[model samples]
Target: MEKEDLKLLQQKVTKLRAEGKYKETIEACYHLLKSGKECNDFKSILTAHINHAASYYCIGDTEEAFNSIEAYVEVCSRFGDEADLLHQYNVLFLLYEYNKDFAKAKATLENCIGLGKKLEKYNIVSNGYSNISHVLMEEGNYGAALEAGQKGLEASKLHKPASPILELRVKLNIAKAYLELNHFHASKALINEMIHDPILESFIREKSQCYHLQGSWYRKQKIFKEAFDSLTVAKELVESYRDLYLLKSIQEERCQLCEQMEDVQLGYRVQKEYISLLNEINKQELALTALKLEIKHSMSDFKRKANTDFLTGIFNRSYLETTSKEWLEQASVKDENIVCILFDIDNFKIINDQYGHLFGDEVIKQVSNACSKTMKENELFARYGGDEFVVLVRGASLESGKKRAEEMRGIIGNVKIEMGGNSVSITSSMGVTDNLDGKVRSFQELFHHADLGLYEAKKSGKNNVCVKLADKE
Candidate 1:
């Protein structure tokens, strides 16, 4: 087939799949595969195999789905990119999970995490950890699930511009784990934190989960009225969203709540509703299964793109500013040290004038890479503006912050990018400040102090570091 024809066929298959026409998608993929094979087009064949698997899975043809996925994986191993491999692992994990093959699902998630870390795909890493937590939770290993949930949250922070939904998911998992462990205070604290987040109102599924968990928390405390109200809201949300799986879970919870309240009539009514919902879900499972898989895949991509900076692959100014305030509040409550560092490329305009914008872009990438290499797990680095960057270090003292800033300066200074026939060197000046007096500094105050330190560094020399302490009063 010609390139344009092949492109058109691919688009047709995609559209059919999105429209829930699984049978038609399968037929189109097979035809495309056959045509491409006649012309020895391995790339097109690989694409067909992947789509074929997804279509088969949606239609409940597990045997054929497995065969298609096997072929897809084999081709991916030979010619696919990291993203391709990540997708394959996710599909495999979901397949195993649906089949109740917990061991295989866990193993696949672990492998996915390894590859995600190797490629610096922090979003994939976070998903892998979250999936692992889910599996552990299902297996009734609350302790392990709690640990995995925490790890997932940590990995999520490594992603640029950190996704709010992803963070909420991890926190919900942790709260569930805590509930199982009878840590009511901890679980309640986490749930209450998200209950009023305006963002939750838009995410129907997440909001349902939040209310469900809140219901569970109330049940544990024997607050029957509150539990009933929360669970009712959760059920309504799930029904409105048409989330059959979550709806089933919510109905079961309602039945349990009714039984605990000694409302036999209500319990019986809920039980019947639950059974009816389960039967309907099973009837439509094949069709909904495929749609769910596609939604999961698209959501991951959407969240990553929404939270990522296209140029530097690091956090942007908005993310830094918003997240830093939350971190500051938490640190203040705990009386822990929180440090901020502001820095910018020294003589950046001269470099741009001498080397052109393209070369200047290369310099920015190289410098960002160098700084990223020096970052600790708890530190956040972001591109504040054209040439300036900011770093937030939690649990760091004034002296330690200064030391880290100096180390970053040294690493950035030694970075050399080869341009044409010349080796161009880059250096940065840094200003460091810390809030250690148990005072909660506003974002503006923190930035102002850090900027003052940067000014002192620039005054002393172009490539140096300076530290400014918070006001003692």
Candidate 2:
């Protein structure tokens, strides 16, 4: 597929989702994913995965939604780039909040807000704060909810193109805080403003929200008939979108209103619907928890595959360089020493020539396994290149680093490979570098000093250990 075709498909899916045509959206996203996969367009694939998950969720297929989202995470972690992990987390917050895990929901929103600020996506930041306010309202922190909602309102205005819907949403959230705090006049004013807006007539979701809040206001004011009318409108609007969360809320409120009116038959009917919705939600909540645990293991494996060497089953150089920067910076801040151990198999090239490449590969794997087995605490191990491995440690001194190097040397010496009914002994030359004088400013410097030490070790007969310090020669 062409890039323009992919972009057009994505826009179609987004439009369908915005219009609440979830079934159609799902179909569109499926086609998008298929095309993206055929063309190896990971960004399109990622968009399809997340959209498909959300569409499935809206249609009440919790299991399928979870499964789809797991695939999304697996793809993102595997590809490393073209991953909107922030958006993934943003979507998960809805599920988390629905499941009543407010803390986790808040944490995910916090992540979204941080990413949004970094990316200069003020709309996302506003949406996050607005959601945080809603969560706070759910937890009965009306004061804090008001503060967050105001912040969301402020943020929504920061975007260049502006988002009218987001501004309204933030205001609605603020009204929720007002209603919960018994500031009836304040809440009623906002609710009335949205309910009468002609522009919102086509926005079923927003209109439903306005009616939902209006109904709440009526219910609190003891105007049961008006409350019933408004809530009925909300229920009808929400049902069109299959927004189970909102549908459930409307049903629960309707049930309460029936009870307040003392209409026994009406109350029983509404109660039954509410109970059914609750049962389905409860079942989905359990399924979500189980799927998350299941996906955790899969995601771990996916991440390992992305970062690990294909043949040696150890961390690869790309992962090493990317991760070491963070570790080195943290170690520097803590005034801790960083140690680097570099080594290579003895006569690895000659072994490949004499015994064949197969034996050489086996030697590398066995040696890596041996060295990894007795790895020092906090050590970062990786295959730096062909037949060469590096281990990094933080908060370790020069003496301990040398001792660790010796242990790795011994472990490599013990690795015996069998070839043609004969056992082959392998040894490795080791070079260790440490921040002995706190001058090992970066991973590059650390690796350079370690390379120097390895040269010395090789000169002293390959099966030896040599230690060097940064800038000390």
Candidate 3:
């Protein structure tokens, strides 16, 4: 091959490498090495393979990088060169770490460490230990990282040209491992050491991550003010990157703060309005209830006027007879006991003769009140005719209902009515009959039996209760 052709190939390789096209640069390097008879030798060939593998590693093509590294190692073994073997180990360790192959990465580092010690290359040992510690820490091997970081720190300090960058990186990683292990004080001490170092000032992103870690630690400590300050600083440093999740976090915090402030300002106003609205609702409810009650009372008075006898103030004959039939039919269906009692103003003609009709009406009203007063809640007291009254008792036997009738008869006989300034007493004769026992086909049958009893009560004596005896078939 011609020297000019090789030189042109070299120029192309240099250009590709400068442009960070490592894969293309490696291909160009290989072409140049193969074309040059002088350059196509053991050492040059191995260098080309290493360059190719490094590019593959940088591009995250680890499979190709591993294949290239294996080929490079075979070539080195063929040449039997141990000079730059530690560099090869370093590259392989990086590739393994990138691939998340922690075991292989650790093993490569161990081999690098041994060779570096033998060669007395403090720089190599320090960098190798740092990388090992980094992988261990990433893999959550805190104890291993701590040990490796300590050894790396010592090696870094002993290097002729001390690498503060490597030292800081190792210390930071060890601090992170301490934090992971919940050794806060040790972690904080290591962090403080790194913070004091002048080199940390140049690494903006690393510094931001450190602040974020500190903020989190403070938050866990319940030191809100310190945490807020640290987080504020961290956010300012990273805001230019426009990280959506972190921006959302900051915005959510701000939203909560704003809501709290608004709540503080408006809480009392809302409470006052709530109380006022409640009072207004109660007032409206009371007014509505009173209006409902007034309407009910007016309707009840209208119903009474329509259905009641004016003189006696009891239900008129028509209403009484209609209601009695409905009660009897319902009671018969339910197989319930029921009784009907009829009462008449005894010797009504004599009363009219003794006093005026007005006085007679007064006597009727007094008698009606006496009967109504004696009636139970389930009993209906109604004036059935001019001088007759009726009572319907639900769920009562004939005997018990006769007793109730007698009680009413006695009450009426004792009550005095004002008749032209003449206080006069009135007596009523009552008759009772069981409607259920008869299973009366009609309300007329109940009234017929009760009327017979009434006639007998007047015949035997005035103001008495008489039960109608069931007739033989």
Candidate 4:
């Protein structure tokens, strides 16, 4: 290959890059590097490789992009090219940031900044600081992001940047970092300059973004009217840009606020009605209260009988299922936690077979007693099936359930029952599951998970408690 041919190949690569055809650009670069022995410009070849790497990075192929950057770094180091070295560091920094390796990304940016300062390349220093701030913001290290953004602004002030538009871009980046860090006043001041400066408008979309940031700041301050007004304007601008998902979210939030307002009004009306009704009640109030108490007592008795296992005096499967559904609904709406425990006597059927029916009944009763004593007050303890019982610890965390289940395991394992003048020890295996606040679990699904956990406990070793992973749900 001649020099003219290599130059033509580089031109074609530049054209492909401009067209955003990254694969074609990389392929052309690879062909030139492989086929052109006559091409002697090592720096130009390294430039092509770095450009190819940047193209891949733009297309979200960061892994391949980083591999290309590594190659470029080696070539640039061999040639002692400081500019390409800085570019390689910046590229690697971005790759780490994209991978959510924030600490490593920050370190790389700082290295780049250090190199830029030593080389008197203020633009590179500003770029490094700006990117570090962006990474910190993304990682929710907002305070650090604001500090880094301010440093970037200071770096920009030290540079005679080639592009005047670069200053506005850097200032906008600083304001964005401030917004993320909840430095609303500082962000607002920077944004106000953008709002009044006509030059800023041509270079950036600052107007709507500034309004959105101000609205969010107002929201944090609990000035709902101000927040709503600003957000409404931002919503209009975002809608014009056809950002439908964000528009829908804003509309949903507005609708929810409206619903909350209506609920408050309705609650007031309900309270008024209750007061009027109570005042209208005359001599019958005492009798009504007495009748209500009697009715409540009767219903409680009826519910107990309906839900209780007759033989063991624990909750039956019917009650556990019904109560579990109710608890599941409450947890779903209120973000409450619930734990379900499924326990079965180990080799229960064998005991029934080896011993007489009376002894079997005694074993079941002993197991139920063990469950009752082990559970907390008002916790649902039910006989789910023959020799199988369930415990529902409402508002129980995973840790709490483990402790409670372990206590039950110990109690059941240590229990000594005298049947037919013989003392026998019984062991039970339990599966415990507690739903987290954000999870939506049905009663049946919860029960199924607990059962699967029980199977695991049995397989691991009987007379123990096992917890299911969140993924099992």
The candidate that wins on TM-score is 2
For residue 362, model 3's alpha carbon misses the true position, in angstroms, by 99
Write one digit per residue (lDDT tens) for candidate 4, span 1-473: 77677778878887888886665676676666544423567755776777767776765667667877877877787884677778778778878877888888888888899999999877788878878877877877877777777787777777874554445556766787777766778887987786576674553344556566666666667676666677667667765654444555555544443344455664454345435444544334465456445534654666577668999988788778777888888888888888888889998888888987788898889878866776677488888888888888887788888888898888888889876698888998999887676375677778888898899999997989899855533
State, as a TM-score between 0 and 1, how close model 4 is to the true structure: 0.47
- Model 2 / residue 428 / CA error / Å: 2.3
- What is the per-residue lDDT of model 3 for residues 361-395, given as tens digits with 9 covering 90 to 100? 87788788767766678988888877888888888
Per-residue C-alpha lDDT of model 1 across residues 128-236, encoded as one tens digit per residue: 8888989999999999999999999998888887688878888889889999999998999999998888889889888988999999899889998799899999999
Q: Which residues of candidate 4, in runs, are more than 4 Å off?
A: 2-8, 35-40, 161-164, 176-183, 205-208, 223-473
Q: Find the 10 residues in a row with the least total lDDT in model 4.
A: 274-283
Where model 2 places Cα greater than 4 Å from the true spot, the runs are 1-201, 210-223, 330-336, 393-400, 459-461, 467-469
| Candidate 1 RMSD to the correct structure | 24.6
Of the two candidates 2 and 4, the one with more favorable lDDT, higher being better, is 2
lDDT of 2 at 450: 94
* Pairs of residues clashing in candidate 2: none
Per-prediction count of colliding residue pairs? 0, 0, 0, 2
Clashing pairs for model 3 are none
**TM-score per candidate, in order?**
0.57, 0.62, 0.45, 0.47
